[model samples]
Target: MTLLDVTGLTVTGRHLIVDGVDLAVSAGETVGLVGESGSGKSLTARAVAGLLPKGLTATGSVTLSGLELLGARERVLRSVRGARVALLMQDPFAMLNPLCTAGVHIAESLPRSPRPPSPFPPTDPGASPFGTVPADPGASPALPQGSGAAPTRWTRATRRAEVLRRLAEVGIDDPSVADRYPFQLSGGMRQRVALAAALARDPELLIADEPTTALDATTQHEILMLLRNVQRARGMGVLLITHDLRVAFELCDRVAVMYAGRLVESGPGFDMAKVPAHPYTAGLLAALPSATVTLSRLEGIPGGVPAAGDVTGTCAFAARCGQADSECTQERPPLREIAPDRHTACLYEVRPRPRAEPRAVTPREASADETLLRIEGLRKRYGGHVALGGVSLRVGRGESVGVVGESGSGKTTLARCVLGLVTPDEGRIELAGLDLTRRARGGGQAHRLVQCVFQDPTTSLNPSLTVGSTLAEAAAQGTPEGRLSVAELLDLVGLPASYAARRPRALSGGQRQRVAIARALAVRPALLICDEPVASLDVSVQAHVLELLRTIGRELGTSLLFITHDLAVVRQITDRTVVLFRGDVVEEGETARILDAPAHDYTRRLLASVPPTP
Candidate 1:
């Protein structure tokens, strides 16, 4: 039986965004919706849940267990919102109330029912031996035989027990966790709490959007396992919306690919991974970072995803497709089954992988004897907690080093200490053989020696300044000929000259990240520090960014200090890898050797936790 179904669904705002979409999820099954950012994956999910933002209208038939929900009244929605259907949003912090306790949130979603009577009667402590009368007559309460009226309301004790049980179901066993706020919990624990709340109502269907995107590799694997177990136990339908093809194949039973608000392909997860039916899907698979060997080059789909409601006539992905023809532009192809259980929307034959020329060996193997960055005995303490405990590392000229660990693993603290953003308690930081750790704070040579690109470009870039001005300020050495020009920097990062006039808000997340990189390069620093630079980007965009960074390191001959929690990313970019655990370096060696034959137990666990490539 279909647990949730959508037919002829279209969402429109300033223009037609999602058009004529059809999909279904049956009981005891898992379906994954995969697409790049702005490809209408989340928008389709919002339409199904009847939670579209203002100005967006959904027109479609959304049926849950044969009940129509499109134009249902608020009262009708109230009956199905939590009890029959539940949604777990992408951002747990955004979905949670910072002011409320975890227990309160879980308790509120529990099903309401009349309380059962206590098993034992209220008796005096002194007269409980043989059913004798109590000395104090008021101590006992009279009760009728057999079946008396049940209590009309639930008590506080009953609610607390139920909340703790729900928390335990998601593996959050700490009793005090129920009393803590969202800010007090880690990202994984917060996600677990969100899952507990979703399970509290015992819904038949669960919609999880980017459930593990913000988590580390180990946390991500654990969450996937949890979801798999929960789905199997309850036989509930799940629609996992995500951008990770590896995750889609790992956790979902069936997978569907979407582009520009349309379903382009659908099939069994394992089969689709081995043999994709659409060019877009094939491109995504090729872009995944391989663990077998270090990838010198990663193929990326050309051009960006089209704007919502801007696609007109023919195939939406034809503009960037290598096999596109005049016939493809003239007619729109209908989705049809190519195999027993696989369906594709394209007219061309599906290829397992794109043909590529032999990858030329990148010349980043040799490092100069000159050291660009040196750190010794780096230590930082925040009150009683040690952020970085006697850590030491070095980066040579034209070499890239990777610092990888989970959250709260001192990766960011090390980056800050290098950039002079945070003062270290005891350490020696040297750039070009000059110690700058104990120097006074100012925009001196220290800032010019090292520049940083943070994880989030949206918050890092100044919204008030134009792209041109931002670069100009960084390259403040007079005329365009004497110093690096804004236009030149923009072109280097793959952006056009005209983008100089646009502000940060006018650009997409990928474009903004490129601009941030360009800004960091305007000064031509000796070493660049990138802190989870591509962690938030889509797979395709991340490939492009990584390629660009590699190009910068090769052409500019600048050293790089990369910090991230993803081992795949580290393998692709870094020459040496340092594994950190709770502010201490557990293992450090050549990137490939450390990953393949880890010496430390923590390093082995880290590699084991990575999502397997299909």
Candidate 2:
């Protein structure tokens, strides 16, 4: 019997969204809802949770445990929410209260959780060394020392013990993490705490909505493993909603492809990954940029999703699909089974492209003596708190150097020092023999020697200016007479000249990234510093941008100081890698060698924490 069932789900507000979609989740299975932004993946989940915003009318039979959710009253759904089903929302910081400790938030989630027979029972035969213990009975356990909390109430203390255990299970080894507020921890660690809190109630249905989107690559892998363990132990059905097809294939038992508020396909993980039947699904799989895939065949859908309010076509994806024909444009396809347990919503059967062959990036053409960036004993002190402890590194011309580290590991600080944005207390940085520490502040030669592409184009670009105008501003030099047109810059970045007239807000995340790259190349900086450039884009788009960066690096012979948390991306982009931890450089070597055989203890932990690649 279906644990949760929905048929002909139609959700509409002031716009056209979530049209006639059907889905079901068994008692103990994971179903992935994969799509890009505004595809109605999230709106469908919200309808199930009875958490839709006001004025939204949902017309469907959302029967969970024989109770309809579409029109359910708030009071009724409240009991079902934490007690029966829990939601792990997209933004961890928004999900957590800033003023509360990790312990405080986790405690609030367990409204009436099942007791573990004993508050401090003996470890389960299957329990790992760092599993959640039963809550203490009779008396609450004491909080960890130096948590900045006075001897507290028994209930609060008991909750703290359970919270600490949960955090540890989610790969946060620092016991004192329970004491830190949400603001103190890194994005990945905070999300781990949020997951711990969500599972505190142990609901039968877990709705994980892009829970790992904001984390570093290593943390993302760890969280995936933790969830796998949790799913096996709890036997809970999960509805994992995300834009990452890779994550869906790796974690979900079954996958559902959504496009413009409709189910385009559904099938087993391996089947969908290996051979997708729908045109949209096939396009999505083909766009992934893996080490194995060549650039000739990897291109994304040309247009964005149909407007939420104007989705009145035969097929929502017809506008962007390469194979779309008259029939595809005239009538929407129904979700019909093409094979056992594999459904397709396409007029014509579409074949999925072959998986890319993963090849190690072998860009070893740069000679060692042709140094592009050189750092010596870089140190930064923030009122006695040292951030970088005698750090030093070098990058040869035409090289991509990867920087890997936990949050606050001096990664961004080092990037800032290299960019000359921050004055280091000690040591010196030079780009092509030009002292960045003593650059021309009056808009001189030093400014043209290096450029930086920061994270989040939304904030980095001037919102008021068009993409064309912003690119022009970056190219501004001493004499106003020597200026390059914005169209030339856009063309250089593989964008249409028409895009030069468009505002930064009008571009997609991937497009915005390309624009940023163009702006950085304006003065032709010898070395480029990229801080998580692709962190904001979808997986398929991420592949394209990485390839773009690699192409630019090769074609221009521009050395890069690329700071990212994604080891997968590192493997395909970086020639050499350096691992940092707690303000100290842990290990530095070739990307393949370091990942395969890390020498330092911290580096080993990082390597171990990465989830086993599927």
Candidate 3:
């Protein structure tokens, strides 16, 4: 039986968006909706769920289990939403209620059942209602108790039992974790909690939107495996909406490639690698680092996705496609059946281009004795948890070093320590032969010696300020001798001088990241510390950013401390690799050696987590 059937689905407000989209998901099937940002993948999902943003109207058929859902009333849709279909949003943190405990999040979604009273009801006035006494004098109570509290519909004991069961299903084995808040858990754990909450609804069809975007490589692998297991056990249909092709290729049974709000091509997941039928699909595959045998310039599709109402009669992707001709631009191509299970919308059948042979990056010759930055015996503790324990590394002048680790592996903490944002419990940091052990906390010359580029450029770049103002301010703060002009800084990052007048909102994600890089370079610091800088960017954009970092290290002779969970990216960009497992340096060596033949088991696991090309 068809779990979901969306035909001629169009979302329109003042402009025509998500035009003529057709998709389906059958029982026990996982269908992937893959595309670049602003490609209407999420919009299609929202159209089916009746969750389109304000002013946007969804037209055509969106039926689930033989029932039409597109034009259903809010009350009618509400009944089907949690019971028949559940949505797992992109950001787990945004989905969670900061005020609620982990248990309540799952418990509230469960079906009605006869429940028992609290197992350990509070008898003492000063004790926690959940049966724990406060250890600190001024500690806030875990569960606040009151004299005449209004009764809830569900029993505490039953809710707690259901919560524990749901948590276990998502791999959180500890029942004690029920009392913890979302903020207390790591990124992976929080995502698991969100999954548990979604599973609580016991829906036949589930929609997961960019579920692993914020997670580490290992954690992402775990989550994908968990999703597969969940689907197998429950025989549930999944409609996965994401930009990450690897995640979709790994989990989904069928893949649909969307561009400019239209389904361009679709086929069985495995066939996507061996036989892609659209130029856009082939381009997306080639853009992946895994697709190449060696580091080469990623042939990113030129030009951005056209805005709604931007393109008229022509094929939406013709503007960016290299094979486009006058016919392609004059007539829109219908989604035509190419094979028994494959379909594509194009003027010509495209195939995956042959990758170039492996070519190793020649090691740059630099002075081995010239150390730009050095760390000795670094130790950092957060109360009882040791974030970093006895870590040591060094970056020579003009060298790029990669710090590889999963979440909670002390990568961010180490970056903070080096940047003087956090004082390490014990460590000696030497920059340019100057020991910044004690004076780092004061934010003097030590702070100016190193500059950082953060992960989310949306958060890092000032939304209110124009690109020109942001770079100009950074340049103003630089040393008089080293200061750069706004135009020069933009040129250094390969951004046009015209972008100076525009704000971050006007730029694409890749452009925003470039502006961030430009701002970082304005100060002309000796050392650059990038913390997951390309984590949120598209694969093509990520390739460009990595190239920019490499160019900076070579042309500018600046030392780079690149921190990321992406081992493939590390291999391409950095000369040396430092593997961190639970705050300890498990392995340190040349990038190629560590990746190709890892000495530590943890390092091997991290590398293995990287999804294979196919």
Candidate 4:
């Protein structure tokens, strides 16, 4: 029996992180952990790996074949940790040893000892007590086709071969990817390496925490598929913990909704996504740009997470759940099966649930005559290949425009050209009627008319500067003191005057992002070119940021060229949208018209990939 049983798992700490939770995973099963930020998804993963941060304490039984996690010695768990159950953490750049070759990391995760089990338990893939397997194969070995991963095809040469295979599976076209170091590879390549290293061990269960949050759209899709492939081929149990349901919908078979360190509901991923039994889960799904009922319409569970003391009695979510009543605050809901395959944690009735958010809205159309910024015959060939092939497009003044495509599709090349960061080898960028190329050698308003918001907020913000100072840096070519004094700019982004004191490390992902936006606006550029702005944020947070960007464009006379692969986001905020396929503008039109009635086949396929809204 190779099932993992986590019963009455109450993980707590000096800070009261996760309280009560129960979960199980059998060989070939994949359990998704979904939640908002600060919900303790990562914390739970760390506890399982015996790598919990300081000040944390766990009191529960996490057993695999009768071995207790909390009761076992660290050394004993260490032996089985990587060899039996592995961890695929978020941010591979920091997880992978920077100095070592990617190959070495894969090799190092291999089993330390090959000795057979001294006293193996009555071995059976079926008839597991944790409900991972059935007693009879004739009765169906397990769930359906995606019930769980099938048995693995692993061998001695599996590490190297699997590494290459997983890389290819994750969409690494170049075979040399296996030989590159973590630093030498692009973000997507590095992520593939991390996946390879995690799967190289051929463990029974794999824990992945927000694996695709850092990747671009095409890369994110590729990575998601790679995980599914690994699960299918190995039939290994997978615990995918993440804040994004869109991710879970793509690969997970089932999902667990967590909040303030508690598992409130769990069931089939598609079912939960389609008909969330819990209000918190429903709100999460509602906040997705794709799930918003209509443009500029959204519903987020109000109030940030309550502190430990503020959530003592009854349901932790009652404070934020709109359906909460006195009974909700007075009694804690139990995890009970509400239907054939669904479980929810709510005492109050969730009568016939509302319709899920729509997957893709009709995109609005872009005006052909109202071209605010136009790129004509853009060409930036790096020695041999063309990065952008005479790319041309237009953005209406004070309008939001979305540009999406695969990696190296000239998305960044085009964005950089617009920002004047990358000088095009050939082309003319006409912004506000002034040609960018004509003024390359002299100071002019055209040069200062556009700004960029990068993908990685960490690298984009200075480590030493406070959020206030970071935002202040955007002032147009003036000394720190001469610019929009830190205070004014901080307030511009809805940040408090006090935020001027907190450094980047002291802030959250959403806050840091606001700081980045604040910095860009400091220059008072006529055009704001944002590149994958909300890719790393949670759904609720993404809704807020995208709305904020759209709001800023409307309130301030700032025209925006918003770039992202999330079609849902484009549908919500953009007045006009452009679909880029392999460095080519395949579709361009009004947001509502294009989003609702996508004409291009690639755009339609992209729309179809999004999860159905409830």
* lDDT by residue (tens digit), candidate 3, 1-614: 78899999988988888888899999889999998898888888888888899999999899999999988889989988877899998789999998888898887777664223222221231321122222221111212234423234556654565577667667776888888998999888889899888877678899999999988998999888777767765678999988888888888999999988788899998988678889888877766775224465544566678864676577888888878889997877999998888999987877456553466765543464787888999999999999999999989888888999999999999998888778899989888877777653445466567899999999999899999999999898788898899999999988889999999999999889989988888888889999999888877677678778878888998889999998877877788889999999999988887887888989888877888865
Question: Each candidate: how many clashes?
Answer: 0, 4, 0, 27
TM-score of candidate 4 relative to the true fold:
0.81
Candidate 4: tens digits of C-alpha lDDT, residues 467-582:
76666555745434435767877776767889889999877777788889888877677789989988877787777677678678878868889888777777777777888776
Q: Local distance difference test, per candidate?
A: 0.83, 0.77, 0.81, 0.71
Lowest summed lDDT window (length 10), candidate 1: 136-145
Off by over 4 Å in 3: 114-155, 291-293, 354-357, 362-368, 440-444
User: Which should have the higher lDDT, number 1 or number 4?
Assistant: 1
lDDT tens digits, residues 1-614, model 2? Answer: 57789888888988869898899999778999998877899989988888888888889789887888777788899878977788887789999999999878877775543243222233232544344433222122433323335243436556666666666556566778878999888787788888888877667888999988777666777677677666666677889999988788888999999888899899998888777888888778766654322233335666677764565568778888878788877766778888999998787778555545555445454555788788888889887668899899889988889998876788999998877778888888877777786445334667777788988888888989988788877888523554456887787778999997788778888888899899988877788899989876876677677878888888888888899876666767788898888677889988877876778888777655543333
Candidate 1 on 416-493: residue-level lDDT in tens? 888877899998988887787875743566676788989999999999999999989888833345378889999999
TM-score of every prediction relative to native: 0.91, 0.86, 0.91, 0.81
Give me the displacement of residue 12 in model 2, in angstroms.
2.3
- Model 3, C-alpha of 76: deviation from truth (Å): 0.7
- Specify the highest-lDDT model's number: 1
Sorting all predicted structures by lDDT, with the top scorer first, yields 1, 3, 2, 4
N/CA/C clash count, model 3: 0
lDDT of 1 at 97: 94
Off by over 4 Å in 1: 114-152, 355-369, 439-442, 477-482
Runs in model 4 lying further than 4 Å from the true structure: 10-14, 95-104, 111-177, 182-189, 291-296, 308-310, 331-341, 351-370, 383-385, 438-448, 462-506, 592-601
Pick out the ten consecutive residues of candidate 4 with the lowest summed lDDT.
135-144
